[model samples]
Target chain A: MDIRKLVGGNVARLRKKTGLKQEPFSEAAGISQSYLSQIENGHVNLTLLGVNDLAQALGVPPIELFRELSEMNPD
Target chain B: MDIRKLVGGNVARLRKKTGLKQEPFSEAAGISQSYLSQIENGHVNLTLLGVNDLAQALGVPPIELFRELSEMNPD
Candidate 1:
């Protein structure tokens, strides 16, 4: 699976677990709501710091942003 | 702890675990040896895809590049 999609899914799932909408959650995340939308949609190649920021806002480990990853065979 | 440093340390350690020098390792990672050096030194804010690429090159899950990450308490 694509890493972006994986991250996006994890973020979305975690955000839902918080029961906060994108708008409020974006505020908590210190990013724009649209950016949060993009993030949930897997449209961003976020910087490492960006990932950390999101993880912090989400109250999860940065690695949680990449939960459920299986080793890929690079082609 | 800084996420970059954590990631850099993980990469550096994993690369060493492979017992390959920077030149060969960089080639496997499909990045310049100098770029690898920067990554290993925590001097780069690599894009999300870049992280995945590095993980693939290292023959590990992309998340392994972020192993040992403890959730940061967003300040």
Candidate 2:
């Protein structure tokens, strides 16, 4: 449905949880702050590599980013 | 860098490989054709749900979708 919003929300949540600002987070994830902002705003499409970078920067599995989906579905 | 193009290329490749039209594939993936089109065109920001749906519809693991990245990197 609202995939952009969903992804943006997830990215924001993860960033906040990591206690990092946009600049540092982007640097850690090897992405530009503008691009990270676009992702957080759901304005840009993401590749698996970008997702992997974010997951690695967060020290978590990529699946963990989507874990909330199961909570909403519960089926 | 070009995440949208990469994702769109992957989706298009997978869809063509399946010998299915956009409608049937969308239906099987439980998504709207417009939405799938957006994804294929790199115009939509996809969530893990959408990715998983496409993966299931294509009869492949999600990781398989990103396997190409390894080949591109090779390091």
Candidate 3:
């Protein structure tokens, strides 16, 4: 269902909401700039590890990312 | 931050909250049972697509997961 697009969009939205740039977010999440960009662009497949890192960096749980994505584009 | 444990716990909680088993959730999310199991146990990584699928199947936004997780385990 084009989940990548949904995830990418959500990441962008959250990053903006928290006033964090890709670099800082990546640093906080312990991810690479390229990987984070890929996620933001729907160009990568995130592992549970990746999402977990993101959750921690964003001060939320991993599921929060998915929940936000769903809210953004509900059925 | 042991994001794995957090994600795994959240997945388990959600599954239980919805009265769903891993098999049904895997089917709904279009993921494999093994993969879903790993996620539930903090043994696998999750892609944006994976999270999106779970969100869609669970009828919630991606961020809601993180929020719930936070509520479950505050800082």
Candidate 4:
């Protein structure tokens, strides 16, 4: 199902929806900009704590990142 | 808000709901039993890949773990 890519896509989408750049968003999330880029590219895995931090910074629930999974083609 | 505890509690609850011991479940999830125990205790951080793996093993969506956050006393 490539959940990592799905999650990464959603994170990037949500970040863009806020009209904030990776630098400011990563700073607000207490993560490095490079890490954020890796996350957006599905190149890195994240802890549950990281998910919470990013969600808080983005003004959303952590589960919001997975909201689109139902619509994704898991095959 | 102690998100770690909340998440740990949920993971434990879901695991118990299946009536399977940690050993079998951990094996199914491709993690060591000790590591699963730590996760159940909220003492270890998990990567996003870990979350997906656990969810797949548990036959649920990864977001299911966070579903109870709203009802939790965050203070």
Candidate 5:
């Protein structure tokens, strides 16, 4: 299901929807801008802690980050 | 909010509920049993991809792992 890409794309989409820049958002999320950029680019694996931090920073539930995941087949 | 513990506890609970042991479940999830054990103990950080893989192995949606997350205050 390309979970990394799904999460990365959603993170970017939601961050943009909130009108937040990577620098400030990453600061609020307790991560560096470069790391957040890597996450947004699907070039990094985000820890569960990272997911919660980013979700909070984006003013959304962690589940919201997986909004596009229903199309996947777990098998 | 202790996200690591939250996810770890839930993962263990769901795994037990499914009647699968760590060895088989870890194999199905494509992770090492030791790594899964660490995750189950809340001693490891799980990436988004890891979360998805575990959720799929557990036969649930990724969000299900965060079922108890509503009590947290993002702020």
Candidate 6:
């Protein structure tokens, strides 16, 4: 899959795993809801710091945002 | 390590691993040598597309660029 798609899916799943909706999560992540929507839709080409910012909001390491599902679970 | 430093070092080492100098490699990567220099120095914020671009230039998967040394080797 494309990295964009992979990242988007991961973001969506992780956000759901944390028990927060887009509004609350985006606020915690310091991004607007519309922007987070775009991110979750695989439409944004994020800056390196943007990756960090999102990861920080999600409490994951920056690299976790980049890994494939297989690499992430490894099981 | 900081992700910027991690990415910078990976770029430099991968470029070297492929036996290409910055000038030629940057030319092949379609980025200016100065920008490639900044990337190698960990002073730039790359877009997701930029990550894909650099990984393409290095002939590695995009996720490889985000991996640490240990992850790369696993040995």
Q: Which candidate leads the pack in DockQ?
A: 1
> Which digits, one per residue and each the tens of the lDDT, describe model 1 over residues B11-66?
99889999999999998777899999999999999889999988988889888888
Q: Rank the candidates by DockQ, best first.
A: 1, 4, 6, 5, 3, 2
TM-score of chain B of each: 0.85, 0.78, 0.76, 0.82, 0.84, 0.90
- TM-score for chain B in model 1: 0.85
Q: Residue A69: error of model 4 in Å?
A: 4.7
Interface RMSD of each: 0.6, 6.0, 3.3, 1.4, 1.4, 1.2
Question: For model 1, what TM-score does chain A reach?
Answer: 0.87
- When sorted by TM-score, best at the front, the candidate numbers are 1, 6, 4, 5, 3, 2
In order, candidate lDDTs are 0.87, 0.70, 0.69, 0.80, 0.82, 0.87
DockQ of 3: 0.50
What is candidate 5's CA lDDT for residue A36?
90
User: Where is the poorest 10-residue window by lDDT in model 6 chain B?
Assistant: B64-73
TM-score of the A-chain for all models: 0.87, 0.77, 0.75, 0.83, 0.81, 0.88
Candidate 1: misplaced stretches above 4 Å? A69-75, B69-75
Q: Is candidate 4 or candidate 5 better by TM-score?
A: 4
Q: List, residue by residue over B1-75, the lDDT tens digit for candidate 5.
A: 477888888899899999999999899888899989999888878887778888999998777777664444354
Each model's backbone clash number: 0, 0, 25, 0, 0, 0
Model 3 lDDT, full chain set:
0.69
Best candidate (score: lDDT): 1
Residue lDDT tens for model 2, B1-75? 345555666787789889998999888888899988888887765655557677778886554444345555587
TM-score of the A chain in candidate 6: the value is 0.88
List, residue by residue over B8-70, the lDDT tens digit for candidate 6.
889999999999999999999999999999999999988888888899889987777777888
Query: For model 4, what is the error of residue A34's alpha carbon versus the real structure, in angstroms, after optimal superposition?
Result: 3.4
List of clashing residue pairs for candidate 4:
none
Cα lDDT tens digits, model 4, B1-75, are 555666677788889989999999898888899998988888877777877877788888877776665565576
TM-score of chain A of 4: 0.83
